[model samples]
Target: MDDAIIRRHLSVGRLTILEVLHDEPGIDEDQLLAEWIRRRPPASQAHARRLPRTIAQLLWQLRNLEWVDDTEGELTITALGEYVREFARLHSPSPFASRTSTVGGHSA
Candidate 1:
């Protein structure tokens, strides 16, 4: 997949979902949504109520990308999903990178 398309398919929220899925395979939607809600900052707690809808949309997007497999009410990360998760981990910007060196140690 094109890097641009891959990046476009991921946002902080979606990437977070992917990461969680990668870590916990076969997690049900409800449990996944609850976990996501629990991770949100207190100020964003208001959005927790919308987790069901948000997670549905995110899962749908990931499904379209073939990164996630929704089987019998359980979501599993596909091989592609694992690849994207690692890609994001490697490419995501770090707070200290801009001030000092890139996460990969290249001068930013």
Candidate 2:
């Protein structure tokens, strides 16, 4: 299988945030952070506590890429973001394609 498109990007955090935005557009920072924390694996929950900083950094990158927009306190994916997200899903290795997909080429 081919590598994920994330290989060409800054960090996995960037790809991760974009995936969340694509799934739940117009979510505010708090909501976004909460969702991210909630989605963390049980074993990762402790580390997930640092998600705010990570989310901030990722949001910066996404904004710099013009892939996300913040308006009226809500975050939403841009046209480019949708395109990138879709392209990544279609072209990334099956394991990394979908947000809910597991490592063994199956949905979680």
Predicted candidate 1 versus true structure: per-residue lDDT over 1-102, tens digit per residue: 876667666666666778788778889998897777666533355665676887799889889999899999889998888887787788876422232232
Q: Candidate 2 on 77-107: residue-level lDDT in tens?
A: 9887777666656655643344444432322
Best by lDDT: 1
Cα lDDT of all candidates, in order? 0.72, 0.67
Measured with C-alpha atoms, the lDDT of residue 38 in candidate 2 is 68
Q: List the residue pairs that clash in candidate 1.
A: none
Where model 1 places Cα greater than 4 Å from the true spot, the runs are 41-45, 94-108
